[model samples]
Target: KLPPDDRLAVLLGVIFCIPGSRRAAMDDSEEDDRGPDESPKRPLKGQACRHTASKSSNDDEREDGANDGQERPSGSEGSPSKKKSRDNIPEPLSSLHGLVPESPPRFVSLEQIMTTANGVTNMMLAHEIAMDDTFKLTKQEHPEKSLEHTVKKILHQAFWQVLEDQLAENPPNYDQAMQLLQEAKETLLGLLLPHNTSLRAEIMEGLDVALVRQQAEHGTLDFGYYARLLISLMARMCAPVRDASVRDLLKIEGVVPLFRGIMDQLEVMKLDMVNFTIQEARPLIQSHSVAYAREKFRAYLETQALLSPGLDPLVHTRAWLRRSHEELRALSAQYSPDPVLNGRGASGPPFAVVLAKAYIQLLCWDPSWEYPETLSMDRERFTLLGAQVEECALVASVLLVTHSVGGASLQDISDFKEDLRSHTRLLLQGCGKCSEEELTEKLKCAASQAIKEVQESLQKHGFAPLQLSQERMLYDQVVSMASAEHHIRKLLTMRILDFIKLTLSSASVGPTKIPAGLSTLEKELTQIAGTFLRLVTHNRAVFGEVYTDIMAQLRAT
Candidate 1:
């Protein structure tokens, strides 16, 4: 509207006075603050054009700035006459800030992205349709293509792309990548559902690889995530077509092998983390989907059973009388070594003692209550006396081992015994309620029968003749092991008393049915009774009073 010079001066002043001018000024100040030894800052003289361009030539100045690849300067510089002359020029014009140079447009076009994404999607869809058709043909008659192979290929492609993309980007666009992966997974799952009979094994294999990658990347395995993913995938694949043949194909055996393979790989790759992961996953593995858990547990049990003998070596021996003396010396060394005796050493750990007791219990159970097929032993009649004996031995072993380690107390043993007795009584009462008279009569008859069987078995097994000698020797060992402490003697007395009470109670109730490959309760009890009797005989001077008291109690009963 005004004269050309005035209009140009106004335009120049506006361009130079923009917010970008402050930014450019601050940048210049920062550069000056860095000191002169760093990169020398060339003063931006071309920026003066922002305050000097003619109104008609403002667009031309912006084009020049873009072409020259130089930033526009802020503020006036030099004498007032020079500033006035520069201010008369028109300001530069730009789509962005007028003070900064514009960058040249890059060559990559958005059309390329849209076209690539569309082409890939279309190709994936076509492949899925082709796979479905092939699966249908294979089911009908032509077996040229397998559904498992097709699904495997699709999953391999999808997972490989995801892994590649993740590795290429430094902090990848993870949300978008995850979405794409999820879509790929869903599509593959859809294809697999209709052809589940043929695809389950391959699908499980693919899942195994994915899980392995996840574990390897994270260092710790997450059972819940893997479990839920598997469950969802299985549900999807099995929901659409419910065929018996297809269901059989989806059976746990086929799927479990793949998961087992994954676990094996994890063990091999990250052995240190495996134990921690297993411990954490224990509850998850046991509670969620119990059928699958049971199968896995059975497999683990079978493996453990195969390895048990090599790990514990004491299970295969019998001839107690012949080996009893030799084992005593070894037991002494194991319990209180020469170094420990000389050095005032503490006892072994409580857990070690627990482990030892568990071993002894296994021996007492084997070939006594539940005869193994390998042993070819005849089954004995049920006797509450035998059950009592097994229970007493287990309790005594736990007490002796725990007490020997200097960890557990006599009070703990007594408390545990009371709990056990209460539980046993509750179990018996739950089995059926009878009148007091009927229960007493049954108890008397069972006790008499048990005594007769014990006498016959002792005679047959030659235990009666060997009992005195074994008891004497074991008693001496117990005294030496206990250092003649009143507490030890008291603990031993409690063990005997508890055994007798449990025996009488068991006799009153009748023998409990044990699992196969375990000894009858009566036989185990007789063995423990003999063992205890030996202890008393060998330590008569120290334990004689308690032994007499126990004998009187047995007689009275």
Candidate 2:
């Protein structure tokens, strides 16, 4: 199988050029008709030629199964250069048959570029969802034309009308009906497994094309009998969810409409079969995905080596773990002498801890520092999680101080707590992403809102508002929370970080074991912790060796 880059190239080639089997035959005929001195045609402007690789039947499937239900860009692991590998690349005529033939390279038209782009996008989406237990293929509904579903309605109507007119003749033509019967039989057979011997025999005997043809010749053609039988077979073969659709087919009357309904139901059943196969294959794919991904990544790196030249593809990786590496080192210094075999990282961080450190970095990741290339599959997810972590931290810490300063006056007021949460969320929108100056300004507003909620709650509960001196003290404490050095904010941050550390330390850990001062955010923090831990655990299993090697190099330096 080709690497991801070449696989994309093959997709581009297939849509733009003739299929290999037909193109080869055409070349042979053209050579026979040409004179001895004749030269082959050259590519014109906006066209180019190159040697194309063949795509294997299972290559795309394997590529999807190789990842942990995510489409990681090929360069994320081995991207050593800024220039893309596909830059100014020539058009390729892919070989989809067996081996790539040594036939002369052919020029390709640029007409199907969008089609190839769409195909690649679909392949990525398939990879991202293949492991989902609830994954199912649903029939796509085409939208109406001119503000109505005229296009689909028109096509179905015209096709059925053709069959009706053909069957209305004196001799009663069965050609279209015969073709429909053949297509239906194949579709039914496709829905069955190899072990379905009895059902297979029944289908073949019941819908025999020869039997229908003979019936037509004798003018005893029973269209109603065939239609009823097809519907009965479909009701038995289809899923329970499709029982309603099968019943709708049964409700239909007349030869034309029934057959039209039968054809549409057959298409739906085919999709169901495909979904069933994916569900059956998911466990096997997931079981072997780790090893498969390792190999796929290895091959990708080899390809990137030629494209990237002398630059190290893992530059960001080393930088990502550099800070954690120093902390772990200094912590080790306070204990004892290090273990031998440093390169294997015997005294270094456990793979789980390494990933935990990486995840923590994600929560506070500097936008200026590039994300680790190895973890690129979850970049967007991390960015979102970072925003949530920052917002939750800010809200929880502010609310804590608010409750303490407001005392029992705000204790029983659930509405007061909710108001604080809403105001905090609004003010902290895009908290970690926007400029620090802007975030500080927003945080100041958040502080004021917290103090206001507490005061409003006290007055509503028939308690006096904070005295002037008390109000000034509470305001100063809350506003100072905007700074990173704020004591109350730092305490809350420490508690949240500790809670995360506990969850990442063990696979069996649960969200129930929340640290003190973070109960207000237990649910949100637990979800973030769980998601981060799961991704890091899987990623560590895939790239633990790489992490070990990088750490050993850092220690040596």
Most accurate candidate by TM-score: 2
lDDT of 2: 0.65
lDDT of 2 by residue, 15-56 (tens): 122212222222221111122333333321111111112223
Could you tell me how far off, in angstroms, the CA of residue 219 lies in candidate 1 after the best superposition? 32
- TM-score for each of the candidates: 0.17, 0.57
lDDT value, residue 378 of candidate 1: 13
How does residue 532 of candidate 2 score in lDDT?
73
* Candidate 1 CA-lDDT value: 0.35
lDDT of each: 0.35, 0.65
Question: Which segments of model 1 are wrong by more than 4 Å?
Answer: 1-484, 487-557
